[model samples]
Target chain A: MFRPFLLACAMLTVSNLTRPGLQPVSFAVEAGKALAIVGPSGAGKSLLLRAIADLDPNDGDVSIDGIERRSVPAPRWRQMAGLLPAETGWWADTVGAHFTSGKPDEASLGQLGLPGDALDWQVARLSTGERQRLGLLRMLMVQPSVLLLDEPTASLDEQSSAQVEQLLGDRLAAGNTIVFASHDERQVARLAYAVMSIRDGVAEPPEAVP
Target chain B: MSQYIALSYWDVVLAAVFLAINGGLSLWLDLRLEKQLLIASVRMVVQLLLIGIILKWVFAATSPTITAAMAAIMAVFAAREIWARQERRLTGVWGYGVGGGAMVFAGVLVTVLALTTQVQPDPWWSPRYALPLFGMILGNTMTGISLGLDTLNATVHRERVAIEAQLCLGATKWQSMAPFARRALRSGFMPIINAMAATGVVSLPGMMTGQILSGVDPEEAVKYQLLVMFLIGGATGLGVLLAVGGGVWRLSDERHRLRLDRLQQTR
Candidate 1:
């Protein structure tokens, strides 16, 4: 019985590695928890998340709750397992228009420490920090089951960064799986429940301490 | 009428001065080589002299077939220029497809629907009737196609992310590129809109001036100019709309994903 179980796990591992550009890099995250990825630039941290989100064309197997990510239609997968890159693009003229979900609630904006009237402002008028905050708000409005953030707070000041961390913590408590990439060790110490370092294209062992 | 005749010499001088100014500006801008300018000047003298001689024969013969042949030649020349101005080398298939499609569709629609149905000319394709009409339509179509292609290419380059993001968001290739399609079509038609606004009072259009110079009645010239304006406007609008709308769809794959690599390779 032990031998059969080991054989089944090996077969599953082999099958996962066969995906294009996707090697079997193993990491696990519990539902409603946050996993922080720390790596040097060009270490494939963003690529890993992109593969899981199926944004980068890749062959390896990735799943959300045992459902293969590729098996889902692209739009449906994006709706559920969204990746937010460092520089979020805004296509609409006004900040309020970016949200397909109704205008972002004042409470949510206030939690991010953004002005309540921010939704009415034109995207061109917003500062870089404001854009980042709005980008984060837009992603949360989607109500994604899995959130992949690539340097989400890289542009924010300490105060705004703390506000973002608090908001993310709230989301985690509410049961959303988060996989975030950051080069900042401080951010990892503050928000990461589990920290994994990526070097080259491979994932390193999770270090118990941030 | 006597006063107008007396001012004909001044008109000739004004036209010569305008041509000199255009030539000087072209030289200043380095848009013309000395050799090319020499060739162009020689060609202009030869071609216009030959046309002057031929016009006497055309007027004498009044042959509709000869007029039709001239119109066809003008369309072919305009099509060649349109094909050359596109930055990417379109497959011969697409060039011929867009060129022949615009010429035939616009040509037939304007000539039949607007011109013949409205004017009831003595011989529908008379040199006086067909040649100028064909020239105006073909010129506008060439301008429209050039603008459409340039605008489409620029939009693809500038808004690549928005396009890709839309595609990743579940938009089929065509749906993803809808913004570019709209921009290109709008750019292609903008000149037509501006020309329509500036017609008559702001500008004494070429055909109207030519008719007046050729001793036609002023009232008759105005009527023909009005008809030609509507015909060219309709032809250009249709040609641009069809060319841009059809051209954008071809830039994508069967999956509706834009084959950007293919476009970049050509560039």
Candidate 2:
């Protein structure tokens, strides 16, 4: 049984590199744990996430729970390994239309510290903070196995930032793996169970903490 | 018929006035291009006069072959304009594809009307009926195709990440670029929509005025205008949709990622 599994794994590794730059970079994201990536800008932190989520061109290896990322179809990969970019895109006219699954109702809005009637609010009227909060909430609603966030709270105020951290903490406690990129050392210290600092496209060894 | 001639002359004079106004404004905006404008006006007058003389003979001869040849010539001119507007050295393959595709698509539709509906005096090619109709369709399709290609290329460059995201999500190459493709197609057809809306109000259309000038009854001229408009709408719509859609397919690779660098270099 183990022999067949190993062969299957080898085959997956080969197929993942079919596109020149589509292979996932090797980084194990444990279930129920949060891994924060700290790096200078343009260090390929966001690109790494994109690659794992099959959103960027790459060549290497990537797997979720030993299942090769490339073996899974892209839609399934996106649904399973969701990436929340620094600036989330809202395609619909109203806030309510952004959510595909859950109702964008008063309770959900209130949870995100938004006005109850935000569901009816036009996207143009929303501030950057509001848009970011809505983007986070939209990602949460998807209930993916892994969450890849690219500086999700870089733009929010301290109070709003703390709220977002708390929300992520709650989700972490409930057993979801998150890999987020940030340059903020304080945010990294607060949220990271393990920190991987990336430099010039290379992921450095994780620092051990007492 | 006498009344129609009077109306045609009146319409032509109004068109000339409008052209003069536009020309004056253009001159005011850029005095440097005055020479260019003069040259363009001269070319237009000479070309139209030549076409008029040739068409007079075509109408007198009333041969289907000559009529078809004239239609083909119009298509060639339109195709050349499309190529020049793109500013790309379309390899022979692309040239054949764009030129033949646009011509056949527009040609078949126009042929059906001219042959079946008896729009012209002759069964196959009535220069009076076919030439003008062909010119309108060819001109519109040329603009549409150029706009479609330009919009498609621009969208691909701007929305690379979104397209990649969609592609990674199991969208085929066509599926990945579908949004941009749709946008291009929309831009291509927008002018046609504007023309349709502006018809008979902002401008008196060319065919109606011409028919009225050349001794056709006002009511009869109006009918022809309506028929031509509908035909144009149908022919151009089909031609542009196919041209843009087919062009997009040719632009990408088997992987579905747009060849951005290649397209950029060409531009």
Candidate 3:
């Protein structure tokens, strides 16, 4: 009976975000679906993702399920629609300190190809690929219903990228909606059910991934 | 008490001769600081002279309202000085209010507490006691608050990515900003801590030295200086806390978002 009415609604809906030299854009992501945003460099893919997360200021209406984003407290909204940026920032000395719930799930870390002892390691010692996977794991720990990822696998090798994609695929199977921006067409074809092309600040309507 | 030795105006003019050496050195070395040195010396003389005259009138009037007004004037100027010292300032009224307001709050609170509980002058708000105590507290509080606020905003600005990352994970604004706030407060407390440590050994504090010069017992002067030090330490800590708290508030919003746009580069 918890939000029984909103069960039928799209997981995420964004409408009319206006930017100079950028077309007004709007779209929706259905429950359990993945929408891949493919674009060239300087095409504002990250900007679109940030705007949707409400991390950056933009004129738009963004809603999770049937609830408007503004109606919920921002932190709660962010939890529901978590964003994973290209290069996630780490401030603490150890990786474990970054986790709010503390001591991130060991199974989840293994799924992302991280060792059990990774949490105790200093942040300065982490490789770029490790950081990317760990960042995704950190975001996943919050269990956002809708994941906004900006080049989630940009730094990973083929094996690591496969692991990440496999992890994301599991989340998808579990009914979480995903909106990801990537330069990798192969990743788009593998993961995204639908695709949107961003060109010169304009996002074309979503279409089936070829 | 020993007889106070009052200095004539000629004595001060003679002291001014000491500055000529610096001015001469600057010119000889081609450091090009001669003009600045001269200007600084003149400004200091003029400002101190003006304050001396104002203090004389203020003491003669001896009205609480006049005393409060004088304190207010000093606080306003201190606030402006705090505002101007920032590299990336909080925009709008906040740029002025956050640090300025903290300095005034801490300064007034500690000074009043000391006056009432310790000194207990006949009127409690006696101009002679109140004015100088407020001035010392305000000066130290201003430094702590300004340093704290500057550290806070600058660190937040530099660490926006890390802060935003925490926010995205559903952390409340306070949770995300706690580390930086702690760091800022530490920086703010450093100056006062060092000054206190060095008060007797490396340096004779200005207030104690002045008291000794004005025929006060050396022991009495030392006691007063200790009181001043403790007051300043408490005021600085409170001021730093308030300023950094205000800074964190200004940098974030109700939505738990880091609004770095609230800061602007000062010219």
Please tell me which predicted candidate would have the highest lDDT against the true structure. 3
* Prediction-by-prediction clash tally: 4, 7, 0
lDDT tens string, model 2, B57-143? 988988778778877777767777766666443345674476348646875776566556756454545566567667776777778
lDDT for each residue of candidate 1 in B92-162, tens digit (9 for 90 to 100):
47755664577567766787665567866776656765665667777877787778876786677667666
The TM-scores of all predictions, comma-separated, are 0.69, 0.71, 0.90
What is the lDDT ranking, best to worst? 3, 1, 2
Tens digit per residue, CA lDDT, model 3, A65-152? 8789889888888888889999899989999988874456567788888988999989999999999998998887777889999999
True contacts kept of each: 0.15, 0.15, 0.64
User: How large is the C-alpha RMSD of every model relative to the true structure?
Assistant: 8.0, 7.0, 3.6
CA-lDDT, candidates in order: 0.70, 0.68, 0.88
| Model 3 residue A15 distance off true place after TM-score fit, in angstroms | 4.0
Which pairs clash inside model 1? A19-A59, A19-A60, A20-A59, B173-B256
lDDT against true structure, model 2: 0.68
Best by TM-score: 3
Q: Please give, for residues A1-210, the per-residue lDDT of candidate 2 as tens digits.
A: 001111111111112322332222445655667788888888778767766665544566666666766576656666566678776665457888766646555665676678777778898788989888988777666666677889989889988888888878866666667889987888888888788787777676566422
Give residue B235's lDDT in candidate 2 (0 to 100). Answer: 71
